[model samples]
Target: MSTSRHPLRGDVLGEQPEAMAAFWRLYGLLWSHGTVDQSIKEIARLRNARTTDCAYCRNVRFAGARDDGLTEDRVALIEDGYETSTLTEREKAVIRYVDTFLHDPAGLTDTQRAELLEHFTPGQLVELTAGVALFLGFSKIAVALGPPPGMPTLVVPTPDWAPGEAQP
Candidate 1:
């Protein structure tokens, strides 16, 4: 609507081309793999954004959740009372993993790992972990660096890609 890209978006492309290129390559590889559902990935990403308090992540990812078919009600409940909410057991499990992954990764107990293994393969677990790491890393940068000067803090930008659409 504003026709103004987040300053961080342009800064990444302009000041650090190599880093941006690497990020896109990694993002393309994982996002298109289809080893995990787009909905699940969106939820996990939103969870990470919330945990990290990255406005940039939310600005970008909120559109993704919608495209992935998550209803407004569902997104609202993600941080409020997810355990008691209507999200599926699989989603709840992913949320649980993200909690542990963000808070105390080394403290993840055997029971937790076993529970995730019950629903997802070892490979899926790895992919999910990778996704978490990517979001966490990028979120840190976004929240820390923030937008460049003279830019408004919040922007309701469109997602770079559509849900379930694979990109190169």
Candidate 2:
């Protein structure tokens, strides 16, 4: 493990404090009050972490998602061949959606579009799409910033702050 810290680990933020604060503010809203189930989003999040190989993102868990029934077994199944795993169809769809969204949005076929529509409302679709984008961008940033001292398996509260409040 590296002993250095990323500037965006909720403190330095590359010396752009207000921008980072705004980012956290939006992130807090996305997690605390999004329409989709927190567990569903968490699954996609973990999947993104694995895809991006972001150590920090992989290590941090969301308590609300866990409470909503995202168990360790389910978490373990969000890997390379998750389609054959025991995860629900909806869960598998979200992972596929994330993978496509991350790898090639233009490649999303009609069948894939219909699969998403089968399981999610338009609003939920928007949220999930935005969520994947956010997770992907941040995960890439965290990875590009380089290793940030050893991180623990932190279970962050979904409600650690108010819906619109930035992390404290």
Candidate 3:
């Protein structure tokens, strides 16, 4: 079967089907089952997408997030100067978390950690951290492997995959 514009699958699946399957399984789980709200997670994910400049990542939106009220207008603030944007405090915290998580996890300060904990349980924090880690790692690989053809921003069902399949 054709890869359906999923570059990560084309490059990584042949040699690492089990691992890729496991990763996508986790992706599905992150979307399907989590303590944190899907909308919040989407905010963080979008922030990562922009910071990484992964065009494919930037163009895809999660259905769960959208259904939970993540509007395109809100998504636009995932860029620089979001701190000054009219985003809610909760949304701002999510962006901060992603920026720190992506750029310098070790530099995470006491205040930042406290702010995140204010809006998240420790378990939620774990989930958010894992999600961003997956996002950053997978998005980079997808971009580096040669991106799929470009498309306008599209809403996709949250990703899931069988052991040997391409992604959405």
Candidate 4:
């Protein structure tokens, strides 16, 4: 289903009306906290989209990442694992946290917390957690609504697959 053809009538704001307004107000405050760089924020979002396999987010964030000077190669790397790449230490830390939080919310160890503490201040940690959690929810909604036509698919190819088997 195309995102433009989503059953919802308006933006998240228009769709949920009062609830989204409250969310936007809260998000505005969180955005002001500046816990993570905007680039990191987008990267975290892309991570969430990838984790959720949300086509809408993958396409939107891919374009946004490129516009922000993230090369296609780097964005592609984010899918397999951002921490394994040449991103800065801090960027890798954030990606690690995002991965852990998404895949193991119930199993976040004290060691992981310490890793986060090493890279982020208390306020920044709060903001990072909030941002990651927010994107988790957003990606769910985007996938449920289905991405717009032409949005890229997040599926990776299996070794046995041939060309054209994986959707773009």
Q: Which number leads on TM-score? A: 2
lDDT of 4 by residue, 53-111 (tens): 88777766433334556665666767675556788777777787888898887887788
Give the per-residue lDDT digits (tens) of candidate 3, residues 1-168: 466554344465457766766777788778777777888888888888888888888899999899988899888877887899988888898888888888888998999888988888898888989999988998897677766776589998866545555654
Q: What is the alpha-carbon lDDT of model 3 when measured against the actual structure?
A: 0.81
Window of ten residues with lowest summed lDDT in model 2 = 5-14
Estimate every model's Cα lDDT from 0 to 1: 0.74, 0.84, 0.81, 0.67
lDDT of 2 by residue, 1-168 (tens): 656654355445647867877777777778887889999999989988988889999998899999999977778889888878888999999988888887888999899899999999999999888888889998998887764668888887774346455555
Q: Estimate each model's TM-score.
A: 0.77, 0.87, 0.85, 0.72
Model 1, stretches more than 4 Å misplaced? 1-10, 62-65, 148-168
TM-score order, best first, reads: 2, 3, 1, 4
Q: What lDDT score is found at residue 127 in candidate 1?
A: 92
Candidate 3 local lDDT, residue 155? 92
TM-score between model 2 and native: 0.87
Error of 4 at 44 (Å): 1.1
After superposition, the stretches of candidate 4 with alpha carbons farther than 4 Å from their true spots are 1-13, 62-73, 152-168
Candidate 1, position 155, lDDT: 25
Clash count, candidate 1: 0
Error of 4 at 69 (Å): 5.7
Identify the superior model by TM-score, candidate 1 or candidate 4: 1
lDDT winner:
2
Local error of candidate 4 at residue 2 (angstroms)? 15
On lDDT, the stronger of 1 and 4 is: 1
Q: List the residue pairs that clash in candidate 1.
A: none
